[model samples]
Target: MNYQWYPGHMTKAKRMMQEDIKLIDLVIELVDARVPLSSRNPDIDELGKNKARLILLNKADLASDECNALWMAYFKTKGYFTVKVNSRNGSGIKAVEGAIQEACKEKIERDRRRGIKNRPVRAMVVGIPNVGKSTFINTFAGKACAKTGNKPGVTKGKQWIRLNKNTELLDTPGILWPKFEDQTVGLHLAMIGSIRDEILNVDELALELIKFLKEHYQGCLEERYGCSESGDVVSVLGEIAESRAGRLKGNELDYTKAAAILIDDFRIGRLGKITLEFP
Candidate 1:
């Protein structure tokens, strides 16, 4: 299957990221815990070079704990400070403040040496679309955060939300385009609802997902849909449809309805916390 992203939007996003990078001491990036490698656009590494970086594996609750740990170690090996987070429920969110301080210790110390004391660290949240970037920003900022309106000589209409005495966040999130050169990456993004479902053939994608689950998860389909582990994607899909009674007027066992059920199950974690890929 072929997937395409807009070059014009990518260019504009890159430009905006560069501008935002200039104004921050650290970059707090969010990646889906289930598909860390696929959910991330490493172009930020080039744009955010020489800046402190922290990777938040968001949606941790929906992903396998083992894979999340592996991704954390993998990113740490590459020099990024990593933390697993369930941003939707505020789990692991508290640790981020401390992580930020630690990530930017050098910058903080430099400011201290220059007679600048107690200036709040500036941070910008960035990620691919639909990776819970908005949810994270809202959770991180909390409802009580005051929107520090525009100040002179600092971009005419920029607004920063003051999180506390030690932190201030740019209200807007930096959106990076999903990486799509790899077919596996595209599939993972499609599975997560980041890529538009209308652009994909759910039946084909569901088949791939079935194959993955049968191989890696081993009996999730049996437990969830009371279907045998036949290792047959199409038949297993049919079983799911019959179990769920996904039928049309003639009751001819709709593969489309079955595919939708299978896809939604995987997307919403009904099949369990399964990670699609590693490293």
Candidate 2:
């Protein structure tokens, strides 16, 4: 249950986001699909008020398809245009361009009424670190896209990637820190490998993961580690140790190493397409 956050970097990130929020017409947020809520910091609601919002459930490849759909509905209920996307492999990415236009249709109409023709929608991609923001940007703004440098009246130095005739995305993504105040939220983020593993007690985290998978995602451990369908969690760890050859010099089961390997398996989708938090 040990979680460490860098407070100084968080404050600076907030300040930078506040400044960036003022110049954009829309916010395209990226979040891990496996742990949607826990992977997010909703303070963007305050920072991005009065701007259009679109949520991209990044890394959809690592999460269950049904869970990803439920999460899309969940965010839609909260007034966001949401879509499941796997930025790494480009699944569901085509839907994003259309979703962007739909999310900003109102603003585009307003500009049209003012006689501003072909003014591309200005947007910024934002997310917690390691949530595929960079990958999304690289793919969305392809090689043909041009980088629009700083303006005269604008901030000292700003970069914008011109996506198309109708859109321009700010190059620098707004870095938002995850809200670690909730202990469960911290645990979910840690399980996804978003937070460094060194900061957590691997044995305790593995036990927590075992309890969750046993209750909600039954058979995942057995499928991944050849677990014998045991009711005892420690025995499950032993099975994993046996399958993965986790052993001490005395040939004793190394539960700690076994636990670390199990967590990594789940994180990397070897265990299964499991959702840490259900909708």
Candidate 3:
């Protein structure tokens, strides 16, 4: 299945961000830890040119710790201040303030040289949909400053939130580009719940996920659902359906239900600390 999701609202959001980019000192981009590169919107680079950049790998609890460390090093090599954070439980949230200060140290020094003091650093938080921008903001600010939801597009417009005397945050809606040049990017995004499930063929996606686990994570499927993973992916999925009691009206196995369960399990990290991409 070809995965592409760009609603009309994203166009407006991108335009608004372009206008607001001039007002901020830093761009704090949040990316899914499982599929860091794919979850990032390329438009952000163009919009945030010449701005201080900090990449927060959200949902770090669900991704492999080894891969997370590698990804942090990878982004740091590219000159982006990177942090591995689990926004839900507040694990790595404390390091963000210092990272932000470090990222904008040059700007801070310039302001100091000009005798401008006590000026708060304005930052714009950006990321693709469902990458946990709102949750990160809420957690970082120590209050429910932005609307939080599990689904994408929770923040509809820009809201400037004053966190403290030294910093302020501008929350923008999540936006994806119009087209994905690499279908693998789309597939990885879909698997990580960045794309809406309503428009996707979950069964097909589940098969693709199973294939990936079989190749990279070897006994994941067998251990999770108690299903044999030696056969073809379809047969593996069938075994999963049987093991999970996904049955329909006539007592036949329901692949759709089974697929939904498997996908949800992966999203919630039931299958273990799995990362879809490597540095």
Candidate 4:
């Protein structure tokens, strides 16, 4: 499948981050725990060079704990300060401040050498759209400081939110690269709702999801929808439609509704804690 989701605002957002990165002491990047590598915009490595980096595996509560551990180890080996967090409920937010200080310890020490005291660390939160950047900002700030939406492109501008005298956060709009060279990266983004649903064929995406689940997480379909897991993707979707009472005007199974339900259930963790990619 071919997938593309680039908005005009993202172009402007990328330019803005280029300028904002110069003013920050750290870059706190959020990535979906389920597809950590796929959800990240590779351009950030160049954009945030020489900056203290923290990678928060946001929405971690919905991903498999085993995968989360592997991802944390993967990022740590790459020298990034990493943490697992459920940003919506503020489960791991408290550790963020200490991690910030630790990640920027070199910068902090330089400030102390130059006789600088009590200067708050300036940080900017960045991620691909819908990866919970705004939600992480709000939970970290202890207030609804950043506007959030379930869909991509909810935040269109930059705002600096002060968490305390010791730290300040710049909340910028989420961004994606100009193009996805690998179709698998695009597919992962689409599965996790990082891309808009309107531009996608929900049934085809659901089929891809079903195929992945059957291969990687055997028996999930049978456990959730009471359908045999051995059939083709469409037949499994049809089973889901029948189980969920989805029907059309002519009494045909409503595959569209069933597809949407299946995707939603997976997104919100109704199926179970699942991880799409492993390190």
Candidate 5:
């Protein structure tokens, strides 16, 4: 399936971010731990040039621990301060403050040299839709400072949140680029629910997921849905439908319902600590 979903507001968001980047001292970007590279917006590198960078692997609890370590090392090698965090439960949130200070240490020292004191570090939090930027803000700030939701595009505009006397965060709406040059990137985003479900084919997506699991995470499908994974993807989905008792009128197996169930299960991490990509 060809996956592409870029609304008009994203263009406006990108423009706003470009304008706001000048005021930001650091860019704190969030990427889904399961698909780190795919969830990142490529335009951010240009927009946030010359700024201190930090990458938070949000939803770290749902991804493999080994893979998370590799991702941290990968980003660190590229000069981005990296942290593994689960914004939902506040795990790894404490390390962010120290990482932020370390990332902006040079800026802090420059300000100190200029005789400026008590100036809060300005950071802009950005990511693609549904990657947990708002949740991280709320968790880190110890309050519901930004709107949080399970679906994409919950944050409509920019807001400034003062986390403490030493730090402030600029929360911006999650934005994706205009086009996905690599279709695999789009597919990875869709699997992680960063793209809206209304524009996707659920059955086809579920089949693609099944194919991945069969290759990388063998027996995951059979363990969760009691479905045999040896045959074609379509047959595996049929087995999943039968196992789940997903039947429509006339007692026909409802592949659509089964597909939705599998997708939901994966999104919530019910399948296992599975990462879609490796470093």
Candidate 6:
């Protein structure tokens, strides 16, 4: 699939982030653990230059534990303070404050030397759409300080939230890049729900997901939907439809409904922990 999605608001969001970055000491970027690289908008590196960086592998519960560790080490090697987080349940959220302090230790010490006491370290949460930016913010701040939604573009403007006396958070709308030069990146984003489902062919996307799972995570389909080990992806999807009772008025198998069910299963981790990308 030739995938590209850059809504008009993203242009304004980027411009706003450029201005907002100046007011923060750190950029707390969140990426989907299943597709870490694909879910990230690399523009943040330039926009947040000279700023302390923290990369939260948000929704880590949906991704393979092995991959999460590897991705954390990968980012650590590149100098980003990394954490695995499941924002929905606040798992690993408490550690974020210490991680932020560690990430900005130099800045904190600089202020100490200059005698600028009690200044809270400022941070802004950023990520591509639907990667759980708002959820992370709300969980980290211990309240519904930011609006939480499953759909993309739920956060339309910026809001600063004070976590404690030592830290403050600026929540910004998720921003996607203008173009996806690598189609694989686009596909990964679509699989993780960062891309809107309305503009996608769910059947084709499901097929791709099936193929990837079959290759990297053998037995996943058979375990979930009793799909046969051998056969084309379409046939496997058909088997899924039959097993899951995806039917229409005439009792015909509804591939579209089956596709939606399977995709939802993957997104919510009902199919078990899965990771779509490697380091």
Once fitted onto the true fold, the runs of candidate 5 whose alpha carbons sit more than 4 angstroms away are: 144-159, 172-178
Candidate 6: pairs in clash: none
- Work out candidate 2's RMSD over C-alphas: 1.3
Clashes of each: 0, 0, 0, 0, 0, 0
Model 5 worst lDDT window (10 residues): 146-155
Clashing pairs in 3: none
* Cα lDDT tens digits for candidate 5, 64-160: 9999999999999999999999999999999999999999999999999999998889888888888998788778988644432222322345566
lDDT of 2 by residue, 1-279 (tens): 666654667777888898888888999989899999888786888889799999999988889989988999999999999988988788888898899999999999999999989988989998887788999998887789998888555567678888888889888765888657778887888888778787789898898999888888888888777787666778888888888956899989989989989898887889878888988
The C-alpha stretches of model 1 lying farther than 4 A from their native spots are none
Candidate 6 residue runs with Cα over 4 Å from true position: 144-159, 172-178, 249-251
Task: Provide the global lDDT of candidate 2 against the true structure.
Answer: 0.85
Q: What's the lDDT of the predicted structure labeled candidate 1?
A: 0.86
**Candidate 6 per-residue lDDT over residues 162-206, each given as its tens digit:** 678788776553354635688999899899887889999999999
**Candidate 2 ranges with C-alpha deviation above 4 Å:** none
Instruction: List the candidates' TM-scores in order.
Output: 0.96, 0.96, 0.91, 0.91, 0.91, 0.91
Clash pairs of candidate 4? none
Question: After superposition, which runs of candidate 4 have C-alpha atoms over 4 Å from their true positions?
Answer: 144-159, 172-178
User: How good is model 1 by TM-score?
Assistant: 0.96
lDDT of 1 by residue, 159-262 (tens): 88999999999877457785467777888888888888888898888888889999899988999999987748888888888888567888688888788888
**Per-model CA lDDT versus the true structure:** 0.86, 0.85, 0.86, 0.86, 0.87, 0.85
- Tens digits of per-residue lDDT for model 3, 54-158: 999999999999999999999999989999999999999999999989999999999999999988788888887788887888789876444322223323455
Stretches of candidate 3 off by over 4 Å are: 144-159, 172-178, 249-251
The model with the greatest lDDT is: 5
